[model samples]
Target: MDTLLSSIEMLARWDVMAALFIGSIGGVLVGAMPGVGAAVAIAIVLPVTFALEPIVGLTALLGIYGSSMFGGAIPAILVNTPGTPVNALTTYDGYPMTQRGEARRALSLAYSASFYGAVFSIVALMLLAPFLAKVAPMFGAREIFLAALLGIVLVIVTHRGQVLPAAILACLGIFLQTIGIESTAYTQRFTFGQPWLQSGVDLIVVVLGLFAISQALVLLMGRDKANDLPPVAKIGFFSQMKDLWLYRRVATVASSFGVICGMIPGVGEFMSQFMSYAYAQRSSKTPELFGKGNPEGIVASEAANNSVPAAAMIPLLALGIPGEELTAMMLAVFYVHNVIPGPQLFTQHMDFIYALYLCLFLLNVIVVAFLFFATRTLMKVMLIPNRFLGIMILTFSLIGVYTLRNSMTDVAIASAFGFFGFILKRLDLPTSPIILGIVLGKLMEDRLRTAMARVREPLDFIDRPIAFILFLMIVLAIAGQVWTVVKSRPNRKGTSHD
Candidate 1:
């Protein structure tokens, strides 16, 4: 009751409302552009938040977090490019819908799903977070270690078809995590005395290089000429609303999947969308229609991706652990304001947190309202030339990386990752596993060290119930991969025989 009242009070403030509107609009615009994500948009805006109240600052950040999902679908539908990595799944069906002259329907589905997912997840976060926060402190080093293991296991299972490559990338990411100084021992693991390397690689730099710069390079490699986009068809707002109503169950299921996946640390929008798409494919009556202008695919992907921003906030708000790169950046913002996240945060700053929830809800409303009025204008941006789009992406990529710490070394690091990303792309290697590994590596290392120090026998550490469960998951993942490989070998052999 008190929390709701406090949220209402915060919403009544003029500055808060203004911040929400501006932030939502900015987030939508930034998210709409290919290769730019909420993280880059928020990082660019973080410094400006230094002047605002805590609630206001968070309102702006949350607005960006929520609306960017919708923004990502813009390029996905129009240009066969995803504005964000999370939106990559959307491209499979969204672009196809556009190619069939259903751009407006695709856009409409994306906006509706994004709005519902964001709103639903925010409601879930508001209701579940406080209870989750109460339980978080009970998690010891062993449980955390198990949790980290489970996260990595899910990554492997989710990318099962390419387990070896994913494992290799994950190990490489873990290796990157060990590059900085060891916190407990005060010893550098892989710094090699270079001052810049001491900080290791920024996750943001790696993500931008892999998703943005590498994508640009791939785009440039494909052709010097650009493909023409289909003309935008007029779509009635009421008609779109009816279409969304028809697929409410699909959106709800996808949003639920997203919320669950988002709650798990390290797995974010990418896995959520993929999982949801798999589920949708299995459940849909017209499974063949998927990847061929299926509206359900757009609903599943968009809902899941949008839901992640809110769901990812769960661990951040409750346990002080960010689930992905964007939330990690948001965590820094909370630190800047001296509002440390975790159990103490809810009790100490309940008003602000509630206000943030309200802002998230309102931001969704704002985005939907804007999309309702300006869908045509926004869709036109999709028709912009590929070369011009590439230039803009490159410019933002440079700016976003430079803004990380205002360091030239960071830019060089980004370029280096760009080259590596290009190589991985050519080899058809998944970059997501590398990201998962990099983010989870340090956490895993820290927990392993702590558990080893406490256990009399090293093997005893794995005997814990949670650890055992994680071990089983790892076994299952490996077994699954082996089975897939064995099955493929026979197919190749039969082809040779034929």
Candidate 2:
């Protein structure tokens, strides 16, 4: 009760409220653009956060995180191009609904589901984070090592069809993450006599390269013709509310899945949205209508994507382990304020922590209200020419990458990754697992080494129940991949019979 009261009191302050408002607007703009995601947006703004009060910094970042989820849905509904990968599932139903003259209904369903999912996850974060914090300290080197392994396995398994390519990319990402000076041994793995490489590749540069610059190159190559979006009709809020209530069960299930997936490390919003969409398809009465404007599909995708920002914070706040790249950046913000996350954060910085809860609650309300009023204008951005959008993305990617360290070397790195990203996209490879691996690699390596060093025999590290369980999961994931590949192979006997 006291914590809640303190948070409410802190939120009533003007600076925090102003930060939230500005951050919300910025988040929406960034998210509406092709290829710009919340991670890139937050990364570009990280240096600015270093100058602000801890509460203010957190409030701003939270606004960006929450609003970006809804913002991504805008492009998906209007243009059939998802602004972020998390919104990819939204396009499966949202764009089709727009083509069917149900644009207003689709947009409305997305907004409502996003609003509800965000608010529900925030509530869960507030209620559960403190208890989880208390339990986190009990996790030692062995447990942490196993948890990291589980995260890697989850990413590989979730990629499904392209598991081998994903695994290769993941290995490459892990190798890249080891380029910087080692925290434990102070040994540099791949600095190669370059002073700039010693600090390693910036997360912002990599994300901008992979998502923004790569997308711009693709758009530019295909800019010979212009593509336009359908006209969206204005619909009443009550009508949209009716639609939402009609598909309440789907929304609930998707939101639940989002919270669960978000709580796990490495498996973030995209997986949640994908899983929810699949689950909805399997259970829907009108499953065949899913890609043809089904309201249930919209509910599943939007709810799951929006729920992730709040729930993804669970691991970060409780265990100092980020569930995804965005939350990992948020951890950097926490460090800037001289506030360490994990078990000590709650007891040491109670007011700031609780205030974050309040900020998240208010952010959802503000984004929904803002979107309701600006839907008409926001939807029009989708009609912009691909060429112009490409130029804008390139400009921002340059600016965003440069802003990270004001170094030309970072820009060069961005270009390199951009080229690699374009090739991966053309090949139908999954990039999410690679990003996940890069984000978790250092932590996984450190924990594994620490756990091994604690035992007389390295294999004895798996004697713990947690380690054994995680090892079994890794085995299962590999087996599942093998089975899938075997099943997909053509049998000579069957081919002859045919």
Candidate 3:
């Protein structure tokens, strides 16, 4: 109660209120714009968070993270373009609905589904967080090291079709992070002789380059096309709200998938949304209608994706491990503010946790309300030229990187990464694993080194029961990946013979 009261006092400030308002609305705007993903938007602003008060800065970022998906559906439903990468699944059902003149209903259903997901994940976080705090400390350095290994392994295998590319990129990220002088031995591994390399790579600079700058290049290089908005009908919000109960089963299941994926390191909205959509399709009596404007499809995708932002924080806040790329960036903000997340955070900063939960809950409601009333206005945002938006994002990226240290070297580094990011996009490879590798690489190294001081044997790393279980899970995951590849060989061989 005291913590809640303290948080309430802290949140009453005007700057916090402004942060919530601007971040939510801005998130929606950027999300509505095609090719401008939430990750890019967050990356552009990550440097600015360093200068603001911790609470104020965090609240603003949280607001953006929480609401962007709601805006993401706008372009998906109307323009058949996904505003954010994760909204790609939403396009399968949303765009078809728009073409059939049910645009309003599709948007409404998407929003309602998002609400169901957002609320469920928030409640789960509230209920599970304290319990997580209690359990976080039971695992030691070896367990954490194993957990980080599991995260890296999961990042590779979860790419499904692009497993090899993801592994290579993850290794590249780990290697990049190891470039500077060693934290323990003080010996440089990859610097070669450059003064800039001595300090190693900056996470923000890398993020700005790979995501923000690279995305800008893609946008600028690509020609923009104008899109026509489908006409929307007037629909009562309350009527649409009541219609959601019919999908409670699917909504509940999808939301559960979101929370579960959000909690596990490396499994993100992509997995949750895909699994939910697949399940919904498999279970529906009218499965044929799934890709053809099915309301259930919208629910499955939106609910699961929206649930992720809050649930992804579970591992971040409880264990200091990021569940996805976005959370990895958010972890940077936590570090900048000197607000470390983990078990000790609960005992030391319970108020911040409670406040953050409340803030997410309210921001969600505000986003739904704002998006509901501004539906007509938002569809118009889709017509803005992608090239112009790309230029603006590039400008923002350069400025943000420059301000970090007022250094030209950082700007150049970011530009190089930007080109790399563009190449990844061109080659159709995942960029997220690299970020994960960078963030988790440092973590795994530190934990492993700490654990090795006492235990040197390979088998000794899994002596703890929890560590053993995690190691087993990692083994099973690898075996499963191999089996999947091996099992597909027979089909290919038989087809060749035929």
Candidate 4:
């Protein structure tokens, strides 16, 4: 009770409120742009924050971090483009829903779920910071490998009927990741003597190509125009609140997974999103509805991704660890303020800690409020002409992919992948597992190599209890999926579902 009072009192200050308002708006716009994420937003504002008090600066940055995940879904829903790479899963159902003229429903579900997930993580962070921090170090290379493996398995399961094609694309993605020089051998495997390929492919470039650019090509070839889009429903701001209430369990489980995964250093939003979506599909009665405009899919992906931002702070606040790039940037700000985050931070800067939590909570509220009121206007995006929108998206794709590395080679890669993605789409192949593979493959390979190097025997990595349990879980998941296919064979015999 005392803690709550102090936090509320601290958050009521004028400077903090002002900063949060501005930061939340800035974050939404930044996140709505493809390729611009929270890290970039924070970096842009960090310079200005140097003149303000530590609390104010930190509050603003937290606002950006908290709201960006929800904002990323805006583009994913209205267009077939993901503003942030983590929003790729959101695109699976979000864009399909948009095509069905359920943009309002999709946006509302994303907003509500994001707010709920952010709040859940904040509460968890307030209560379990120390405990989670202590447990975080237990996740070494072996555990990380398991987490990556689980993600791959779940993604494969997401495409139940197209498992073979998805697995092939996934393998291709992994092969693409191996294009650069081999780490241990110091020799190139697929670079083919090209100096540009030595650095490997960038995730952002691939994401833009896969979702944004390929989508533009489809729009160009299609007969439909943007103005031909279905009219937005006249549902009020809270009309979809019932759907959110109905899926409370999905939100809770995904949020819990987010917090748990986020607490581990270097495990970012992708793992949580993949794991939560897989879990939601595994448990859902209408599992077939996923990837075809299901609200639950949006809820699961948005909630899990949003939950990660706050839970990510747990390790940063409690153990002085930066879980990912965004937290690493926050660490720089903390050091500038002479605020060392460790065991002493809680005792020495209790007010700041409480204030930070309060600010994060309020940031979510501010973003939700802004989005709710502005949703109708945002949905008007669907009314734009497809030709113009396609051109704009193509331009955005080119610029975003190029700016990430400023290399002509990267631009070429984006164009090539854009074509490849379109071909896969025509073939009815799932591109998501490929993107997932590209994202997780490097981490998996690096971790497994490190764990193997340290252990004398191959099985030593699985000797630990955590690793052993994860291995069993993987086996069970695979077996369960196989059984599901075998059992459904009778039903699918004549229909030939794929």
Error of 4 at 452 (Å): 1.8
Best by lDDT: 3
**Which of 2 and 4 is the better model by lDDT?**
2
| Per-residue C-alpha lDDT of model 3 across residues 383-409, encoded as one tens digit per residue | 888899898999999999999999999
Give the winner by TM-score: 3
Candidate 1 Cα errors over 4 Å, as ranges: 6-23, 35-61, 78-106, 199-239, 265-297, 320-324, 328-355, 396-406, 448-453, 459-498
Q: Return whichever of 1 and 3 wins on TM-score.
A: 3
lDDT per residue as tens, model 1, 321-421: 66655676566567667876665676666777777777888888889888877866776555555566566666777777787688888888887887788
Local distance difference test, candidate 2: 0.78
* lDDT, residue 28, model 2: 81
Whichever of 1 and 4 has more TM-score, that candidate is 1
lDDT of all predictions: 0.76, 0.78, 0.89, 0.76
Tens digit per residue, CA lDDT, model 4, 229-309: 344554455776777998999999999999988876555688889999999999999999999998889999999999998
Tens digits of per-residue lDDT for model 2 on 1-498?
Answer: 887787789888899899999998778877776565776677557657767888888889889988987888888888898877788888989999888888888889998999878887888877776686576676677777667667777777677677778789888878888888877778886998888888987665676787667877887877543447677666456556677888888888898888998888767787888889999999988899988888899999999988888887767776567766677677777766677666566666667677887787788888888887787887665556677877877887788777767889999999998888888888878665656677667668877787777799767877877677768877887788788888989876846533
* Model 3 CA RMSD to the hidden true structure, in angstroms: 1.8
TM-score of 4: 0.61
Which runs of model 4 end up more than 4 angstroms from their true locations? 1-114, 125-128, 223-363, 491-498
For residue 327, give model 2's deviation from the true position in Å.
2.8
| Alpha carbon deviation, residue 63, candidate 1 (Å) | 3.3
